[model samples]
Target: MPILEDLKEYAERATGLHRPGKRQAAELPHPRKPHVVRFRDDGLVPNHPRWPLTLYRSAVRIDERHDPAAVLEDLFEANGWGDSWRNGIYDYVHYHSRIHEVLGIARGKGRVRFGGNKGRIFTLKAGDVAILPAGTGHQCLSEEDDFLVVGAYPPVGTYDECTEVEDRPKALQRIPKVPVPRKDPVYGADGPLLRLWKKSK
Candidate 1:
């Protein structure tokens, strides 16, 4: 709860807003990467212009100390958004090839399920951390009154990086209007990078 309060205070001081649902444009400093963290006041609002129903995202970065799992919990608890839950049920599905994510839980309790098959679902509490391997399907099932989430993406960005590049037909053509599911989950798979870590193992 202290984390949530701190984030709220930071958001208010940064944007002059008391709630997390409102959108406020602010510049965040990242010594390790070039990125921006946009704060929102409305919970139901979407982070992108195309996806209005998609969950709102606050303070995204590539910091090593701030994991995605921990940040997510904090965001949920601070905004009173409830706990994390399994993917493909009530949570958003990446549906794309493969991507890595780090989540932070600030408040409440929830669980995360990774991969379509042979995946693991982790129960997360306040200050808990979860990592989703690339090409793995992930979702969060909320169990608490509210939950806060802070997510981190790789330097290339989640999904395809080509979409952001101008005048790149290859990237644009390869980009899908909707994300596609991976043939297999990245965790426990035989690969040097895939073997990096496991939520359960």
Candidate 2:
């Protein structure tokens, strides 16, 4: 519960613009909550610093982009350190205002749910992929054994230039109500970062 509280506080502080527009007093829903699977007992890594709540290193990165297929192949490939991708969760929550994400469920069953919306869960199994549009809040629900998720993003420096508009009017103006789909998709060959990860022998 402390972790959830902490996440809530962090989100509130990070956003700066609270419900009443006052500093040091803000409330925001915890973006995503994934039950701590491992890393709680001893630690995520051996002898790591132990705090009241454990924090696992996030494998996913805002800067890294790869192919869904190739990334999946590499995970199971012998030379690719098969066990490296065995099981893990990325603790880091990424917020990309300019880019969308393509998530591919490669080898197991899991759930993806966007924040602020209940009953919008998408359950995925092997070979199933979901495309999450930009600014749509989301988080992983559960990761079954050997669950593998591959994400794709735009080119290097593309997201870096992204601007986060906090002002309500500005943010509203930036986002179009018409919802025209982008020419280049976010998470697959349909995405901008195409073939970044290729199947290897």
Candidate 3:
């Protein structure tokens, strides 16, 4: 029955039947300050040297009465992070060198390792969001069956996945050049993300 509902919901979304902007939309409550964590380049991972990964716990309100992934999509798009996808995190270790990403946990929970082999595992639950700077490594160590995340990128860069050690040499060169996001996916221009990233430079 749940899968059936999910199928129907997906169909409606694809057909542009479910999204109501400004009205009938799920409200996104302002979240607390994010917890910032930095990582060193583990050689293979090529973690960002300046910008740190940002984590927002219970950052959004996941309403069960409505499709939660849509809530994230709407919010991210509004904040200049567009072209979102609904899916689970990749199980294998990987990092993005061409662009930064924001992950909104729409449903369920997962233990995600950030910063490659040297990273820490954090349990992310519904309504949580993680803002990954370019070159930061991330992987899903474990997850709930219903785990779903809404991932989006800023307009500034392309989305490229780096999964192999062979990708390192090029990644190290490309990572530093990846443009930092101009807006925070959750809080727009006034968010702490812009401030932190600016201060890092």
Candidate 4:
């Protein structure tokens, strides 16, 4: 059987058995923290204190049988992440207060700005992933015509849009309280996110 099909079967059986297990992807070397861009509070955006925004490049192997977004959704769900969605980033700036978010670039390329107006920007392509801690601001700067992204949140908290000054206080409060996810979205328990985030905290 093909690998993707085998994964699907394994997932179905695991679900039926009510056991927590994940089918492994092609293992890439663990990403180092220096590759990540950490955004801080820039007044307008109250970035998380305990968590930092992290990005992984060329993290997954891409091929014809797999849609990057679909693969990411499965990877995240296997790692105890939920609330997955398939879409592009919003044109305007926004942040989530109550939950951390992960974005996997499924196709094309795009430039995105993180950490409010003062934050740095990133150019991303297919197979790349970004993990945004709570209260980190992000905006879509530009993208290729075929651009697409998949997003999801950890299982701990509900998601809330925080786009105004009135939302700041509540957002600030919630950012630190959001617990680290049990497993890294793309690499399950052993992924870079677990090492980086746990060390930072």
- RMSD in Å for all candidates: 15.2, 20.3, 2.7, 6.0
Task: Supply the TM-score for candidate 3.
Answer: 0.90
Which residue window of length 10 is worst by lDDT in model 2? Answer: 47-56
Please give the RMSD of candidate 2 to the true structure: 20.3
Task: Candidate 1: list runs displaced more than 4 Å.
Answer: 1-98, 160-201
Poorly placed runs, candidate 4 (over 4 Å): 1-34
The digit string of per-residue lDDT tens for model 3 on 1-201 reads 346546755775787655544233324745678899999988789889899999999888766555777778878887889878888888989999999999999889899999998889999999899999999999999999989888999999888999888999998999889876888888887889999988887
lDDT of 2 by residue, 7-97 (tens): 5435543663222221111111112222111111111111101111111112211112332334332322211112112222242222334
Q: Model 2: which residue pairs collide? A: 102-187
Return the candidate ranking by lDDT, descending.
3, 4, 1, 2
TM-score per prediction, in order, is 0.38, 0.39, 0.90, 0.83
**Candidate 2, TM-score vs. the true structure?**
0.39
Kindly list the per-residue Cα lDDT of model 4 for residues 1-201, writing each as its tens digit: 235434654564555432223353334224534266677788878877766788888776666655555566666677777777777899888999888899988788999998899998899898888999888899999999878787888888888888888888878877888888888887777777878888887
Residue-level lDDT for 127 in candidate 2: 48
Would you list the C-alpha lDDT of every candidate in the order shown? Answer: 0.34, 0.32, 0.85, 0.76
Better of 1 and 2 by lDDT: 1
Which pairs of residues collide in model 4?
none
